[model samples]
Target: MYESCFYFVINMSISGSLVILSLLIVRQIKIISRRLLYVLWFVALIRMLLPFAISSSISVFNYLSGLIKKLIPVGNLFDANFTVSNYFNAALSYSPMEYKTQRFEHVFGISSCIWLMGVCISLIAIIVIYCSTIRQYKNAVHLKDNIYEDKTVLSPFLLGIRNPKIILPIGLDISSSQAVHIIAHEKTHMQRMDNLWRIIGLGTVCIHWFNPIAWFGFFFFLNDMELSCDEATTKTYGFAKKKEYAEALFSIAGNRQNKNLIHASFGKSDTKSRVLNVLAYKRLSVFGIAASIAFLLLVAIMLLTNPKV
Candidate 1:
């Protein structure tokens, strides 16, 4: 009952946020590929798999086991029984009285060991990146109402956690550019709540906590998002104006002198891919979009409603 309730709350929080995000995507900003958004959603699922504690310390026991097995002298070395028993005791703080539980945990062999180690690594990476990203985000300055304010001009990232606002440097002004397509591009991120997507991707790192596939999924989703946003910008402006958009992309990217931790600047290292995808936009048939939508919905429904977990 408690688990059900907990899962329900998590589900509600996630769903509610997504609904708000989708509404913002529709009304406030434009997006190209909805399919890409779904891929990001997958990355997010991988991130939030388990809590921090269990995943965090999997590596300690793993290392201890390896160290003892490899480092102990042949005559003085503790054999498997002593080593595993000691590890269980140390990792779980088990008392000699709790022999049954200790035995069970100690008896856990290679497969569980490998899986747990993977989880710990994934969790650590996710956590480290998350904190770093937060610090970066907090550093960028937010601009108040100016003529540029109407254009949704986000500043380049600044440094550190405190007093971090998006920095609109002296010469590099996105809001003032002749190509208005850039505004739609960044606004699409805000409207779709790309920050939440980032959280999800990071969360997957925590969940899978060890899978390279999860990291790949995150990058793929991010790239797709950029591509989708590019498509939307093209649709809003026009395909023939690709060079203008490309030039604007170049300008925004070229001036990124500031390097902050992770506030997710408008144009980051993704500058090249974003420009390349804009030039590569191809019109999809009604059937393609429909099928992709169906796939995403089906996967989401199955994962969400399945009772077994």
Candidate 2:
């Protein structure tokens, strides 16, 4: 059990870094649908969370693991008992007595305890932030059905998990058309259950807070989510309103503050890129759609499956 926990964290860290590098490559391709990218990130999130994977002959992990073993004389790269502390101790020729007790297995047990401490700290921080955000909006004024006007927030966002409510800023000079677009966008987020995905991503962060790539990948994943929502809203409202939607983003983004963390806001942090994606949005050709599906399947197989060595 001790070894299992350590290896799970190691695998998650490696897989997350791979996902980040892969997304960086994929983002450079302009012809692909943004919606497809959203799905790909979700798969990456699941990849980071799971420990066991299906084995394939052509798996990327198999080849990469073999190359890593050849390049670095790390102690038993695939050993169940191998851990970060052991790897460092072997590489550096030094061991901290506190961690490396009399018994060898105690090293891993100590390392696992440290890793778990980080996870607990991350989860507690998230809970505190979530509770604080909820408390700030406790006095929000109810507008029309299910919508509330709050002076605390700059942009409109959806709050709550079970009975999710839409909260818009109090003073927005929105035309009826723009109002429709904004409402539609937030509604699409709820319809697609994006908040649940956000929570899952948060869980991933809490578990792997030590990995910088995990943090960046999760942020990029959230951006793709908003872009995907933009794609859906445009599909429903017609692509002619793309400019209007983009303008709405810019206007709201100017007022956006870095206060809330729990709510899914209408305006994203990377508003410029999102608006550009909206303007650059094109209908996927039949071949493009098919190719997109094939590419996603390929990525899923490569990242989620391990090669049987």
Candidate 3:
């Protein structure tokens, strides 16, 4: 169990590096489609959850490993005679095997216990918060099909995984253009199944609670999700409707409350970034779309694969 925990920590460190690389790529490709940016973050999320990948010579990790070797002596980090593969294999075997040192074993056991404790606390906290939020909104008035009006919530958000309810706050004119845009935005989140994705992202963070980079990646992923949804909702709208969409977004942000991780709130994330993306929305040409797809594939190949052995 201790060996398994150590292996998990190593995998998470690799995934954190992937998150950093993805963030750099996102920064460079800010002009690309927001949906594509969301996809890039999704790739990072997959890395966080999965432990293995196919090795490739072109992988960014390959170069990074070389750079590290040049900057720091590998022998200083570990015993020159130590065999990593033998140690790892022995750790996995069920039969009793000789350990190099009792101190190492004791340290690993203690660390594993600490990691497990953190996981339990993080998971329990998330569940408690989610259940409390559900209880708070249990009596939400059903205004229409799959839509509810909750006086407590200050912004519109989608809740539930199987049967998501779009919750709107009180005093909003449903007939007005801003209301139309807000509803459309929530519907877009449902269409994209963003609530499910948000849950998965949060779960990943809970498991990797000790890693600050994982938390950063999770929040960035949420921001990207909102930006993509905004792009999708306003894709067909003209300048005036896009303006109205931005206005609706701004209104929601101003009155935003309930920034829960479990629910996909319309105005919960980086509102400044979302509003800017909405106002700068432009239809991509065929060539531009093709380029974006190619870029996505490139990112998948470069970052998703393991360093060549």
Candidate 4:
């Protein structure tokens, strides 16, 4: 029994440590250390799978050992005690009776310690980033109301903490050609509640501090969001407006200077991929839309399976 419990604790810790190691390797050595990450994945799998197999085998072995002891003619000198050794002896730490409870309590500690460490790291990151964003937002200036006469204009660091307001240079009138597309674009972002997702995503990462899959999942999620938004904006305005939108985007991107800690209002740094997705996008067929919805549902299932922190 003692040996089995020890095995389970070891197995669980290895499972957890490998998850953390995968993230650290990605951060530190980039692709050079990723092969080791694959090995870690295999190690994690074995650690998780072995316990049930080993427990079943050990239980059978223990039964056989007990049976063998019973079959023998026992004398004081020939005594064969097969009792599993209690890890805690009164001579060491606990009273003899306490060992029964202490073994399980010990295993539980391993999980608690791991979760605690993750929590600590997450809290510190959240606090730091939160403070930084607040500082930027406080320092931002409010510019005059923008009127789109169907022209696009490049603006600097436009942000609105409350209400609809564009923060750019004073006495500027964006061309009617560009203003129409730009207004539609920025307003769509505000309407979709994307700014809320930025906050929510950051908070979630804190809780899931140990999962590497979460990071990649979030990166692609954000990128796809931009691509999808671009698609919607372009499709609504029609293909004729693509050049105007693209040019506006390029101009803003060139002048875009975000606060050090705040998420960019326009899009992230993957402009090349965003440009490709925008240029390549074709109108979705009914079947294609249905298939895309089905894929989203499948991913939702995996997310639902995870126990929320």
Candidate 5:
């Protein structure tokens, strides 16, 4: 059991680190829209979820693993029967401790337990945070179906898993133009099922709590999601309202509070990116749109699948 868990964690961490590297590369390409990056992040999420992937000879992992195997011959690392003597033998090349005092199985069992405990702690923390957020909004007034107004909240956000609603802060009185932009942005989130995605991302983080790359992926994924939603809102209101939209973002930059990770809000996670994307917003030509779609599809295929051995 310990050996199985060890391999599972290793595989998960490798896939997640690959995703982080891909994201870093994609970030340097300015021509790609945030909408496309949003889809890419979703593909990464799918990669993290499905353990078994369709392998291909052209897969990136295959080449990387081949190079690694050439440099460090670790062919016996994943043997079916991983014994204590094997570990002690490997440890001997480094600094070997007392042989009788340490058993490989005991150490492996404890390490696996620690990983499980981390996941449990993450879930518990999320639940506590969610309850606390709800309690803070207890005095909120229902303005409409699935919408609430609260004085405590600094910016607008959507909270709840089932039938999530848009929330607005009571003192947030902006011009009608700005409100229109903000409302459209939040509505676009609902239309695209972003709140559900937020929850999914949070759950993924809980499962891969040991991987720092996964956490970074989650943060950047949320930023891309907001940027994508901004792009959608731009498309809806026409590119002519770009200046107004950017202004709306600036006006709502009031609160820098760390929101519940599970909630989808019209808050600023990356204000500079949002404002810059807004200012540079332009509708893609028909051919450009088609090309973008094809490029993202190919990227999804490469990022989500495993390489043939």
Candidate 6:
């Protein structure tokens, strides 16, 4: 068990490094299509969850690993002959000299226990927050097909995973153009199945709670998700309608309430950036589209593979 825990920590460390690299790349290419940005974030999330991948010499981790090998006595730190089970059995026999020699294994067992405790606490907190949020929205009044109005909700959002319902604030004018944009935005989230991805991203954060980079990755993922949805929701709008969409976003932003990871709320994240993205929106030309695809493929190959060991 201690060995398994140690490997899990190592995997998470590698994934965190990938997250940092992805963020830096995204920052440099901020003008790219936000959908591509979201996809890159999704790839990072997958890296955090999966422990193994195809190793490649081109992977950045390969260079980092070589540097680490130079700085640390890797062979001495992890002896090929040492096994966790053997260490524990020797420990139980109460041999003082054996115990003194297996100090590293003893420390590893304690560290594993601490990691397990953190995981349990993180999971419990997630469950409690989700359940509490659900209970608050339980009395939402169904207005029409898959749409509900709630007096308590400050802004419109899509709730639930398997059977999502768009929840609108009670005072929203459903016939107005702004209301149309808001509804369209929530519908876009449903079409993208963003709530599912959001859940997965959050799960990765919970598992890697000790890594601050993991939290940063999750928040950036949410921001990109919202930006991408905004782009999709307003893709076909004219200048005037796009301006109206920005206004709709601003109005929703004013009424924004506490954010819930499970709920895909319109105007819940990076409102200023979303507004700018909407106003600055331009359709990609054929050449531009091709370039974007090429860039995405490059990012996938560079970030998704493991170091050749």
lDDT of 5 at 182: 74
Deviating ranges (above 4 Å) for candidate 5: 1-3, 65-102, 173-175
RMSD to native, candidate 4: 14.5
Q: Residue-wise lDDT of candidate 2 within 215-256, one digit each (tens)?
A: 888888887888888887786445568888888888888877
Query: All candidates' TM-scores?
Result: 0.50, 0.83, 0.86, 0.52, 0.84, 0.85
The 10-residue segment with the lowest total lDDT in model 4: 300-309
Ranking by lDDT: 6, 3, 2, 5, 1, 4
Clashing pairs in 6: none
lDDT tens digits by residue: candidate 3, 105-176: 687788778888888898898789778877778899988898888888899998877788888997777888
Candidate 4 has a TM-score of: 0.52
Which predicted model would earn the best lDDT?
6
> Candidate 2 — worst ten consecutive residues by lDDT sum?
81-90
Local accuracy of candidate 5 as per-residue lDDT tens digits, 1-309 = 755655455565667578677876997799989988888888778766654555555555655643232111224554332211111122334544657446865776787788888878988887788788777777788876676778777778777766767778785553478766777788888888887898788888788887888888899999998999988888755556788888878878876556667777776677888989977877899999999999987777677656544
Model 4, residue 20: distance off in Å is: 16
Better candidate by lDDT, 3 or 6: 6
lDDT of 6 by residue, 24-119 (tens): 567567688888788888678767775445556676555553333211113444543221111123233455576565786777778777877887
1 against 4, candidate with superior lDDT:
1
lDDT of 4 by residue, 158-276 (tens): 24334534434334445555555556666665666555555555555444445565445445445544556677777655555676677666755665444322342453346665565
Candidate numbers, best TM-score first, in rank order: 3, 6, 5, 2, 4, 1
lDDT measured at residue 189 in model 1 versus the true structure, 0 to 100: 55
Off by over 4 Å in 4: 1-121, 124-128, 139-141, 144-172, 175-180, 256-264, 285-287, 298-309
Evaluated against the true structure, the overall lDDT of model 5 is 0.72
Q: Which stretches of candidate 2 lie over 4 Å from their true place?
A: 1-3, 65-107, 173-175, 236-239
